[model samples]
Target chain A: MSTALSQKLDAVSGNASGGHRVNPGELDLSHKVILYLDGISVSFDGFKALNDLSLTIDAGELRAIIGPNGAGKTTMMDVITGKTRPDSGTAFFGQSLDLTRMNEPEIAHAGIGRKFQKPTIFEQLTVFENLELAMKTDKRVWKSLFAQLASDERDRVADTLQRIRLVDEADRLAGLLSHGQKQWLEIGMLLMQEPRLLLLDEPVAGMTDEETERTAELFVSLAGKHSLVVVEHDMAFVEALGGKVTVLHEGAVLAEGDLATVQNDARVIEVYLGR
Target chain B: MRTPLSVRMFQSLPRTAWLALAIFAAIAWIAIPAAHLLLPESSPFHVSAYTVTLLGKILCYAVVAVAMDLIWGYAGILSLGHGVFFALGGYAFGMYLMRQIGTDGSYGVALPDFMVFLDWKALPWFWVGSDSFLWALIMVVAVPGLLAFVFGWFAFRSRIKGVYFSIITQALTYATMLLFFRNETGFGGNNGFTDFKRILGYDITSPQMRLVLFGLSAALLIAVLILGRYLVTSKFGRVLAAIRDAESRVRFIGYQPTQYKLAIWTLSAVLCALAGALYVPQVGIINPSEMSPANSIEIAVWVAVGGRGTLIGGVIGAFIVNLAKSFFTVSFPDYWLFFLGFLFIGVTLFLPDGVVGLWRKLRGKRAIEDTDTPTETPADAKGASA
Candidate 1:
């Protein structure tokens, strides 16, 4: 079983060939697009949460998604992370791995990490243990039971503590950390996996001005090494990231361009100011 | 240089925990047995057979409480059907005990007296190898483990949780109890399996046999406590606790929540079965009543009252509740159920952390005082304040 799983991981890590066929773990990013969603629609009982949404994210690009409430900002992230299945669409990681065919953990294992809107760290565990859990290790039950942190893994956790500015609070329970600290810890957890792409929902929703600026710096630093798709209501935070922006209205992309251009778009203004 | 075995064992647990376990082992293995067997009946120091049996019974219950804690307390899967697993284990062992009766039964036939009474001609197909003590041991673990695996696989795969999960487990045990009560199901109807003559060829009621069983029960409890401690402290245990706290977060971190729940659920069932296997020989009876939904709910109360997450708390809870049960059932038999209900309510409201949590809070306060220099108040003190 372990061998079979390792073989599958190997397939995922190997170079992906150009193909239209759906492969479980293959990702061909030679075309530069890391995530491709075309003609996607999702509904709840007759209400359309996402309607005919199409978006593409380029490799190593940090893209921010902005929209009014119920604009399907959260829904789009849900569809990408396999939290919610679209009724009809083709969603792919790179060009081959089908996102629709995968589950949440499988999507994550395929190297897409998601940070929820709320800061969701394991409150009972120490800050170090929380990061340790998110580290890219074998997640099988028996393997985890006997697993001891290698020196390098320990060093990585320590490094994350310093990076998140929680070095002094490393041993403290995560629940005891202040709200901003918990958000940083969650972001730090996502970073530990060294994910190929990250989907963060409201990354700076509840941070002070200084913390928000630091977070903006952190995301900027992470941009080229990892592709990031950030969804936020904070227009200033999005401007700080300085990325190409997509605005969604009623589950469809209404505007797409640089942040300044999208902000001034007629539909974007109508949805924001008109409401 | 390689570490010595003694050092390694010590490192696995704290020095104080080891000392406590050693003391318990000495009492169970040497002192208790000596008092029961060596001391004269007239002597005040004599430990009666009744006391030994009762303690053994409570030890089995303690093991069950610990197993329940593993799933409910740590994994956040409150299984109200744990009694099903416990009773299945008891019935498995009880089958072998029944077969051991052989010609000694009331009917003096190859079949158990129940079969003769029912006018049945042959043993049921399910009882084929049940006469073998080894097979009984295997079934004691396997039956409950398999049931839990299958049940958890389906329920967890579908993502059933919280009170809904609890309701389904209660229903499962309720259904099993009803099935066992039917005579055609071949579990001896409501009377279940009883009237044991021997186990491994020794008279079941002999002092030597009873003492042996009592000693084994104590040893198993300690072993389970140690095993439970090791597991909860491991990374796997950390993940289980994480699932309890935030299951969706666990999934987002690339863990299949179902798989973790199923693994722990199956393990917890196996532990309950082992406890049940020990229980039958000392209690000398196994009945469908053992699988009643109320009994399983009581198992949760024991863990909750003792402190859910603490491994030692489960053991302590089992002993405390059952000891009270023995006294109340005898002294004030009619009010015992009401008393139990009140105790559960009291623990839920006033002692949410159980006895262990209470102890920790007190110790935390004392430690703060001993420091003499006050810095920031501890997190536990904050909890106490709240």
Candidate 2:
């Protein structure tokens, strides 16, 4: 598996000389690790947002990262998604593509999809269109000008609408959707991308209890098919995710284990969950 | 699956839209020209040259309005400097018209009167191929398209958007206007280019030429409407609207908003340039004032008044506003500016969706389900901030 991964990386680096067509989204998860960040450090205007943040997510792993405010959960996601460049360290998708070198669109095309803390769907477009735009396809300007949805693509969109439970609201303007529906629609958009890694920030922030449970179930079902990294403040929702929980504090990992184990850690209690 | 371009273009508009276009084409190509040329001067149906020129001029303005709408309305990039592209196109074509004068100028020195007056020995480097009609046509699209491409590339890459983008565009045109006003610029100084004798060896001032130019303007407007309709309905247009609403979101979704914005921005500029090229021959004048910031702002007003995002709205808006301008300027010249100011204010407050939206409401029909209306979307809260 590692040999296959190295060959892929070799071909990627030698692409100019080899004159090979570089197909995106063919991420090398042969080593069973979908992501890697080692000694990553980022500072903003003299303030360190992330310091020596090292983390890894194995393929098909479901992990929840929780921390107090300004603990760098979002900053980590930003670094991973190429929104914020790190001052130092190595961040890799699979084993070859450097996260630090790529831009947002490049990173996204590399099979990493992020759902912001606030649902950021295209509000002016219809609900179905939001998913369509997010679909994994040739998104070039000239191509999009004449793009017509293939039967399979349309079926996928319809399928995503059902999974996200927005089938009824598919035709409605996204702006008119309720908050929970918008969240689902956004998730549906992510699903349409068929990403390898899903970084969800506060996915259940404003959802009702039932909606929150449904979202939890959806995330659980998505875990084996896609690696999930969720950053959330809701302990109940995190507990419902039922996965290895990582505690972040002051821009670095403080504790990492099962939710119960992390909850019992003294340092985690001191920095986050208190007596 | 991609459909053939010709098939897609033909099917872009509805049958009703096609019918409307056919009627408009009949009037412009057959009726108006016949009235101007075939009818006797004493006949009521006789269309005077002034009326034909005025209508031709409005048709040109309508094209500008649609081009403005393509960028500002659908893409949400309000450029208050489209006048530069329009004027640049005018200057490029106007150069050809000036050269067509040969030695018929006041000095008869084989040079344009302005160049002779400035005591210039030869044509400037930029005017080397001014005599070639094909070269002028190429320059008409190339100059504005290149400028727009480069300008849009830099501006969009830096993520300049919203009101800031609007301000810079205004500044761009204002600066261009000032530069053109200089005697050293070689574009006929403040007077610009005028006093054309012929085009392609045919007398330009003849009734035949006027009708030809007028017909061409009408044809261009129809073509623009069809093209604009094709664009806004395409998946590409949906992406444009999406970027307008949430640019950062678009970036995260694996689509480079800069490319889309730049493509549309440059295309819009080229469209405006085409309109400007048609405008110069019909109006018989191209001056530095055409690039004024105020003129650019007026183009936005036409799009706004017509109801943006709907291509047809731009045509209606241009006719309505320019026709009103002609009337008010002739009758109550002093009050025209004030009236215009009030018109804009009133439209912003009461007719937020412009005349088309109001018409939709009055008819008890919803706006074309697909027409993107800024006010109706809750998108402003997020609005291209990233």
Candidate 3:
């Protein structure tokens, strides 16, 4: 199992142009963890969704969390983002940032951005305006009253459009976008927020192969710049993402290794693959 | 008819054009007072004192309606007792006017005519120092502001919103009306404080005074509308709409909505009070009946009848409703209330957005169709299997 983890790392080391790439060295894992989670528990009506679980991600690391349905993956994301505060535990960001002490918006302002299972864009606003608004920029009364998008601000918007690859469709209404496009726009909004940490829930839940590939391209490009924690059920997409894959089962880390080792593990096969 | 051509031209024009038109209307309003001052005394288009006074009264109502819109249309707080605030301001101003009358009153006593008629020995405690115009102006702004603050603090803190908030506000106005109706309260009871002698030493019935009052009211109405626009277009206004659309979400967005709600509520009250201060001397009365809950509810009708979210619409609605009211009461006095009730029902049901909203729909340009789209982008199906 250790070899499996190191072997994936070794491949990325060997080929600068590695395929099915999982970079063990792109992120400085030796750096003190940015987000720390330990002994976190949440229950809904006596059912323990997140039991005594613990995890940590280094600053700028892209860690993908994979689990079957009912594995408490969504709840874990909820706990980190402050949507659902744990019944008990210490969830911290950086050295002294106690996430448990904050609320959702505070958490968002504290540099954690969450993309929910469903997109919640301001439907009334246009696509570009939605992204601009999400930047949470120009919060001043004067800026809003004057309402002239400055030249640099306009350039930043254009840059974000290019990064999201929605520059062509910047003028299109967000509602008019295709499902894949909407998902990309939502991701674009989160990206424009320029969060230090991003918790993306099921980002590839329903994507065409082309879109999925492009999203993989997008995430791969983003890995070194921002610490990404993606919770998804798609193993193939996960493999495409190529990171330290943590397989969560019944609210605990059942296995942590490359997919081949986890796939062949008897326990993981029974709990997740059902083989 | 050439109506369709004009309508098409209007529809095809940009939002800037619409804003330009509103600006022109305000300039024209200021022009009226200028004409009264400078134009020949008997020129046909030159405004008469009576006409100016009547228009001034309409302008005062427009200010009140704008205040109503600030709360109801923007904040989603429907205050059904706004008339209480307006009346409170009027009575405050009236107190000063009363004191100005002094020994010139019908009874020729130090106290108001009603007080001397009732055989009062001295001035009431609340009536002290009300003779100063400066003090009266302070009371005009403060009385309503403080009351709204107290009322809003309790009601909003309790988390009582929607129709319940509306009903409680109505009850507040009704109770105040009954309280002021009693003669022993020293507010002239049912007679409601009339026989004004002077406003800042100018003869109350002087035509020049009436014209000046008209200009003041018109200027104020224009100022409030401009202020309302500035406020509604700000980030604060976006948060207000967010509160209106989803309060919980606003909290999640890192803002405590109560402060925002209270600020706008107090602002609306102050505006209404200013309107009342302008309203009283022009109309020549400051009666307790002004506090009637029905009048407050009618303010809501004005906001709805014009266009709730649009501030200028509220002013237009107030002007149209009252003009219709004047025309209707004179022509068919028996059915005025019936006409108003049905008018409100028809607007709410059919228009939903109000007349300005309907007009925007017709115009099509700058129409913000808020709810016609679905969200939650579905990830590509192939990506899911991948």
Candidate 4:
């Protein structure tokens, strides 16, 4: 299983591979907004999880959502991806498509991919098949009957494998991989779909320190090219993601700023850290 | 324990294996009939009286087994109304057989012996043209297919799932059983249709005709098993498997599961009906008893006992269970029910996937757990830099 030419990044600059160190002042955010959530509220059995929560993510922006347990972070991901329809709200994708009206599969087809707290790569398939199957959706009886990956598809798959750093293990069954490898494989699966927006829930929750550091590096590289909304509780991982942070308390945004600015905010401390 | 023979066979030259299956089927088709014709009646290769009847019944069961595996093993649908589908097919074919017996019936008149015995004036509107084998064959396929479509449409659209769905299917079969039991239904009132004269003008009593039907059944069984195996390996097969593990996840990946579920479900029912159509003639009777709730439940136990999700395992399961059934009923009539119950419990507890599943679990689990590797998360700096 050789690496594909397209997704392979050039050699690491001394220390970091695929790590593109960015200067904050160079960010150009005047582009069109890709995702807009307005006046959305959801309740489960009389418990309000999202109360009039509205937020926007411009194309290529990586937004971090940090909150305590049950602050509606996961629920928010569900609403956007169409897993759970909000009771009332307006969620738009690319300034037009009414997301609230669409179902999960429709939203997925419309280009929003989500990775759950636990990685869910197909365990029975090989790593290469995991990515290849993710890219294929022509599930007709005959089409599936004669499925064979094209040459460019082969190249793209090889490229994705190298990008995920699993090119050497392409033929290996995914279930045989480590927990962190499983997580990466699932992320790779989501990438194969080429989603415009990604909703990742606790992507680094259960990983070794090294795996966590590597994941932080991966998210940093993924942010601008694809608008990403990452929900995590790890402060160090958050520091690695250096950008505007939205601190959630109960079901609404308590504070939004740079990591240092939000950490020092009295209200943020009162609800989150609680001196 | 290394790599299962079937998986290795499928992996090495898949097209060649398919060719082999086709060639084997062709040989069986010609050789069995030819052996019965050319070889002496006492020859070992010649089809025997006992073997002919047994093979016909086994063929019918094979069709039903394939249908069950399609829904339960592939589409993640566990149906308990398959017996009803089979009976509907039998009744369709039975009507033709009853018509064939016309004027030669017990009372010796133009009425079915049951209608004559029950003192009916004329044929029921539904029974009209059942005298034609062509019409009966069409009904045999159509009735079960239509019922399945309507049932699956409502069940799938509403998104009923899990054990709840299985219970509902059981209830449907139970209801149909009650409907067909009444004396007023004109379906022979418990003592179902028998004493057939002919089918399509061929003497039903002939040993040669019996041998032909048996050969057809054996060949059909082998063919359906091959088709089932092919289906579960394809991309659509992956979708169905994904649906089984996580429906919401698969739906998020852009597959409307209802359509796929319903399509496979209806196909399973139709196959069961075809099996039933073939079954009634060889078994020498067609009755409402075939639609019993208990019978359908038994089929599930058969599949579970064989191992689930592996297509061919269901066939082995059916043959073993039913073969044991015939022996137990004759040898130890009082212990048959208890023996089956114990077998079901044992399989569920120790071999949840069936025999093949148990074997796969032991072998595949070791292979998967023995190796470990590092995670492959991309360590790029693009997102961190922002």
Q: Name the best candidate (by lDDT).
A: 2
Give the winner by TM-score: 2 or 3: 2
Alpha-carbon shift of residue A185 in model 2 (angstroms): 0.6
Candidate 2 segments whose C-alpha is farther than 4 A from its true place: A1-26, A273-275, B367-369, B372-386
Ranking by lDDT: 2, 1, 3, 4
TM-score (chain B only), all candidates: 0.92, 0.95, 0.87, 0.85
The digit string of per-residue lDDT tens for model 2 on B42-141 reads 9999999999999999999999999999988889999999999999999999999999999899998778999999999999899999999999999999
- What TM-scores do the predictions have? 0.93, 0.93, 0.77, 0.85
All candidates' lDDT scores? 0.86, 0.88, 0.76, 0.75
Q: Which DockQ values do the candidates obtain, in the order shown?
A: 0.48, 0.48, 0.13, 0.26
Q: Write the per-residue lDDT of candidate 3 for residues A19-66, one digit (tens) a residue.
A: 433332231123346788999988999998988889988776888898
How does chain A of candidate 3 score by TM-score against the true chain A?
0.84
The residue-by-residue lDDT of candidate 3 on B1-386, one tens digit each, is 11232332343234674686577566545677677767887887787766677778888998999999988888889999999999998999989988888799877778888988888999989888798899999999999999999989888877789999999999999999999999999898988988887988889888677777877887787678667765664446655765676565344334456777888898999999999998998888888889988899899999989988788788879988998998899899999999999999999999877878888899885555322111112111222332
**Model 4 chain A — which ten-residue stretch has the worst lDDT?**
A5-14
**CA displacement after TM-score superposition, residue A252 of candidate 2 (Å):** 1.0
Q: Which ten contiguous residues of candidate 2 chain A have the minimum total lDDT? A: A1-10
Q: Just chain B of model 4: what TM-score?
A: 0.85
